[model samples]
Target: MAVPDPRGGPAPAARAGRPRIAIVGPTHPYKGGIAQHTTELAHRLARRGHDVWIESWSAQYPARLYPGQQRVDAPEMEPFPATGYPLSWWRPDGWVRLGRRLRRRADAVVVVVVTPIQAPAYLGILAGLGRAGRRAAGPAVLALCHNVLPHERRRLDEPLIRAVLRRAGAVLVHTDAEATRAAALTAAPVRVAAMAPHLWTAPSRRVHAADAPAAPDRAGEPAGQATGEATSALGGPRRRLLFFGLVRPYKGLDVLLRALAAGPPDVALTVAGEFWGGQEATQALVAELGLADRVELRPGYVDAADVPALFAAADALVLPYRAGTASQNVDLAHLHGLPVVATSVGTLPAAVSDGVDGLLVPPGDPAALAAALRRLYEPGVLTALAAKVRPPDTAGGWERYLDTLLEAIEGQRRVDHR
Candidate 1:
């Protein structure tokens, strides 16, 4: 026999071992990477016979918390089916109410931690889950941290995120480094699960053409056709690099600009993403570095339709992070058949196979990135890397990710029983 969903419709528990799971996070009509990841995870979990409820937000945050544009006109990916919008940022009581409801209904609760600002809401949820009461038992709480802290940290970030982690039964992070950060925050067991492939990897998504071969090794060749950039001062073939996604200070667009300036003057760059701030500063730097003509800046949110043109035009995608974490850009680049040139920060070093898929340099080092740029334009380097570029094992990856998540929840339950 099945059970009743706390909200409505039929629920899980028709089986013996499967648990009723609730994942608290942003889902449609929210947009962005986190939303996509949350939605996909729920769908997959349900497919595996678990009753999964996406306890999404009625109001995720105030404008001050995330200044960037939020929703898309359409769902960024497939909208999750069983989502409930019971919690809002302004309403503290609702958080507790939802927690109490989950405490009664769910066997496990996965708290998706995207930013530190939502810490209070999570704390409220924990309180209602009976963590503060004698009932101190409810759903097994698992904090799934995309990042332990924000990429750009604030003074209160650590303490705030720490509070939520301390309350959880277990914490799950995408990288070992993030696992270490979670361990420091709470006595809760930390488990490292490779970031699941939440990206759209179907054949239909591969609308962009593979990159053309790099220009000849010699200088003074009008190799503009090889890439979509203008010829260099030496009239060498210009290599166009892409800097995709939302532009943030921590992501190192400035360092990449300096790298572009230091590198072969024939190299050109296309920065296609919404900027969080510093657009004027970026423009001034481009002008100061004499990259005004060579750098094409499309300063707004990129629509899905326009993505193909951006990838089609670039020889490779670039990730120059001063600080970092797991990102979908490497896989995004590979999906479009473009290799990546990234700093060996966060999961980039692992995703990007140096000398095989793309090049990697030290974080924040403009000189090293420039050298990698130079080497990329070498006769066969770019083409060779592009040839070796392959889509990530998204199917197997998700299965493994789910296994890791379940094990952590089970392991924590065993620990609690002891």
Candidate 2:
């Protein structure tokens, strides 16, 4: 059963008849937040009696262009279909045709915007859809922005960013910080919504047995002492630390390994997921730090089916990303009620309440990360953190998020009419 979102409430009626919605983004074989968000949003909207369709990519990225494996997660779930819509960089007309078909069918279009790397594909699809349906007056395009700017810093990104934002009728950002940046990017207004609750695998609400053997105490409390509430797998006696997802330089896995090496010898680290450019460098660094024994490297792209076992085995999740706009890893950790240890980069601090839900350290600071690890390593810390950590509110109550979009649409409609 899907868990109820903590922040979910009643939503206002969505037009008279059920509204038709088209969600366009990287889905299925492609993993990560972009894919997950697209899937969850479709699922949510479908449940609400909306005629929903997902225009996922047929060809997302070439092997050379990808940092890790071909796809992020395995195609275990039915949602992970082999192919649906093919994206050809050379054939913009073919893509535009497909987009027009979707636009004709959909009452509204929700485009999931990512980095510049995907700008060409998304921008083309949006254009196609807009041209497809002659909407004298209807729902405008809604761009759900994960990041207003690009990572790795590119001179070309600003122009592309400006173009996409200017093209959209309205925009939705998960955080206020992103909203502020989006405001500056385009004349189209940006609205802020709480991060979607089911961005990753849904949370498990099954309460753990109190006084269960080896049950760890709450954070800021003693070991073997129950906090009266059920503890997550992380709060169990054997603490597991997960560095789940594809490995990237900005993700800072090397710093996490070094922190484990320099800190307590008892704490263990699981370096799961496929590696990118820095894998060799990271492996060498692990050996140099003498963490070969303490660190378990499960290299290669991990399948989504395996995530439960991987996360269940761990005590806490570590996201030492040196630079990031926002991440679903932190949200995934919260879904399991597993405490997180992340650096103060982008919107990380907003998700993790230092000393309340999880610890926050400076990005790229191994020492501070080591210290945070030690804090979590202390038995029962994660249980306490879990009690206080609130999962994001995204469910039947998506209207709150939609309100932000509607406000922009209404405002823009006024302007367009004027």
Candidate number achieving the greatest lDDT relative to the actual structure: 1
- 1-418: candidate 1 lDDT, tens digit per residue: 2333547443445356777888999987886778878988987787788878788887888988678777766555667667788889999999898888887778889999888889999999999887754334777889999999988788999999988888888899999999888898888889999987776422235321122122223223232344633334324555688899999999999999999999977778889998898899999999999998789898987766676667767788999998888998887777777879999889999999999989999998999999999999888777778778887677788889999999988887676667
RMSD of each: 4.8, 7.6
Q: What are the runs in model 1 whose C-alpha is more than 4 Å off? A: 1-14, 133-135, 201-238, 416-418
Q: Kindly list the per-residue Cα lDDT of model 2 for residues 34-142, writing each as its tens digit.
A: 6766766665555556556676676666667775655643432336221245565456675666566655555567778877767776667667766223232334677
C-alpha lDDT values of all predictions: 0.80, 0.65
TM for candidate 1 is: 0.89
What TM-score does structure 2 among the candidates reach? 0.78
How much is 326 displaced in model 2, in angstroms? 2.6
